[model samples]
Target: MLITNQLGQVLVQHVDYRDTCLLPGGAADKGESPAHSAGRELREELGVTVPLDRCLAVDWVSPDSVSVPAATRFPGEILHVFDGGTWDDARISDIRLPRSEITAIDFAEPAQLPDLLSPPDARRALSALRARLNSAGTVVLENGCPLAPGVLDRIGVLQTDRPSYRYPWHPGPAPHDRTVTQVWGWLFAPDGRVMVLLEPDTAVDILPGGTPEEQDQGDPVATLRRETAEEAAARFTNPLLLGHVTDPASRRGYLRYAAALTEVGPAQPDPATGHTYTRILATPEQAAELFDWGPATAHQLSAVHQARRQLGLPRAARLPVTELTDPITC
Candidate 1:
């Protein structure tokens, strides 16, 4: 069974027998359906009664495909993963693990699965997460690899660890006492999808703005324009300052903006990294999920959408995020 918390972190278990972490579940008893077994395992292992109504994925492993202890040639097995629903502090506090089998449990980020689990397990967990996000019901996998993957799968979303920053957003004027060192914008396209730049090294999603260069002459809009052009080969109009946040670590203000994308030029390497970014357009909600801003994501996204409406842009359709391979050419 695949369980998660409100923040989308997977609830994983640690056992004495296995070095890697495991999602909560065990083999099904005879005459028991997969869903029933999942519920039963939760009761026996964690002493919880989480409903297992949603089937997220089904995986089939081939014989001798993966090695395991106490087996010369590993036999094949069919695995069914069900949703255990999101748990809160009260529900998590009630958990009672059978120490003889499951030793401990932790809520792990999706990107942390690779380090915590075996390759196949990591792949299966990530695929199941995408399946849950997708409109399609259940995903099928062979050797824990998705047979029909979506955009998120193809681009390897959640493959890298996200930065931990929960800076409080001040949706008002920038503090006159502090220096606004950085500027970032959610540049919206005519279709209402916002632009996000994928970092070359980490592939993490980020807005295409940066520190205000001296040449920018202390103009946040100027910084936004130059940064967007250099990072994404994109230009925008009608830059609207949403607000600013004071980074406790840096003691500098980070400005936020909402603008309408005007034109996209050919892709070029960013001067800083000397590598071209993988740019994509996502709905404001989707962009919020890509960032690890905690609750502040909703606040920024709300402001972005409101700015979008003010700019006379339509709400983006609910679809998979789109990769802009070459915005001008594509």
Candidate 2:
């Protein structure tokens, strides 16, 4: 049998079982069980031994005179089915094929299974296995190839489960005023560019600033300098706090600020300490289209920067906010 992964990629195998294509297994030896015989036959036939984990079925073939049942191999023979270890081998070797009895060995999606067996048995031998593969993040391709990096989609569990994203917040009376820890000066070039960072499946498009820690001996401006160098690896020659938004219920708000500074050096990719992304710059519209941004932030950016012309501002500095968390490098 040419075993394959959830994906339809075929691995090394012996025969296609003379076109019958049910999982190949023979009769048991003197004292060994049917399943034991199956395990042995699997190894001998495919040259790759699999430790049987569970018995899948015991198909007892018979000749029903009432209505001729579907033709089956091992007629009057007991078909013992078993599941085994994962098929991880990429190639098959030392294969001994009997061409006169078996022509080829190939893996395929269940929809392309042979038409010899009864529908139910075929489902057990193929369809059910395909479903299991899909749930295991094993995609069976048309060319009998199984894609690697096995991962089951969350949607499978969600089919019978419901979940939601939530922000854990304290449930208490709203405070009168929240403390402002740090104010960051975000500087952007004039070419409608901005800095952003990314990680898999999650993104954050924000300025290079944070709140002052208790250990910090200086003010919020000093904190911004420290955070910028620490997080973005860029030195700030000039930073100015612009405005402040206070929310009593919220833990803290920012003293929003902006300034003009040179991004004179290479913007290193996120060191991946946390989910990190490099700085990016684009027009409001371009930023939204190029990267995944939250609706509120995208709208604000779009309103402020219109094709690089902010009506009357003599020298304003702003950049697009974006983040990429995909695993592959951009």
Candidate 3:
């Protein structure tokens, strides 16, 4: 099983008998299940006992595999990689490694695995990392890439040739003239409806997002956190990069837009950006109807819905109209 910390570094162990490093897991004991064995191994090796969250990938390695030896006890092996949720710096500091079996223990970024682990072990770790970040189901890997049954489809993108529209009341210039980037979040409720912020004066509903600033540099997720807080005063969790879109007609002749799947928190007014907004939780159909920015707006909302469905989220249902209220005053 592959374990990673909050910084996205995979835990690796230096075995005294082997020249290359490996993930923190060993052969299952006589009555112990694979999952239980993983837990027990961690406790023995690192002095940490974390429940294996879920199986991320299953890889079949033959005796001829580059990482496997011909004199090995088993001619073939099926490895089940499990997700050990992020460990904070505090917990990471508490890790204690056994000296006899493990010479050293450290966290290495995914990109560094190739230099540290054997060929097959590197493939397994990379596959597990990709599955942990993108897919909800267990990914089957032949080498390092997905198997035949699993297809890697583009997550977010909607092509359009129409000239972009710029609102008269828009706070800044449009992206038609130069390249511009923006980050937004599709904040979904437990009930399945998505939250959209209503521009009180324009009577237009839009996702909680905005253009990046000098402070954001090039990090879209950081821009998302700042913009979401300013627009809706809402906190979100599990922000996954849904994908990005490109529109050639905007300010820099292109628009780089990214979205994340978010969980909405309480809404309040931002004192820094005194903009009045009405928070509305609506289904995809309602958002398509309520957004007054034209067909492009509706198309974007539909794309968001499709992304959610692709991520295995429940279908959204029509929300009550009564839930829509007047704009909140600062």
Q: Clashes per prediction?
A: 0, 26, 9
Give stretches of model 3 more than 4 Å off: 67-69, 143-145, 149-330
Best by TM-score: 1
**Cα lDDT of model 1 by residue, 20-88, tens digit:** 999998889999999999998999989999767799999998876676554654466899989888787
Q: Between candidates 2 and 3, which one is better according to lDDT? A: 3
lDDT of 3 at 73: 36
Whole-model lDDT for model 2 versus the true structure? 0.42
Q: Write the per-residue lDDT of candidate 3 for residues 186-253, one digit (tens) a residue.
A: 76655566667765444345677777788888666677778877877665654645444444444332
Worst 10 residues of 2 by lDDT: 156-165
Query: If both were scored by TM-score, which would come out higher, candidate 1 or candidate 2?
Result: 1
Alpha carbon deviation, residue 49, candidate 2 (Å): 65
For residues 134-219, write the lDDT of model 2, one tens digit per residue. 23322332212122312112111111111111212222222346566545444445443543322223333345666677656746
| lDDT for model 1 | 0.83
TM-score of each: 0.87, 0.34, 0.49
Global lDDT of each candidate: 0.83, 0.42, 0.61
* Higher-ranked by TM-score: 2 or 3: 3
Ranking by TM-score: 1, 3, 2
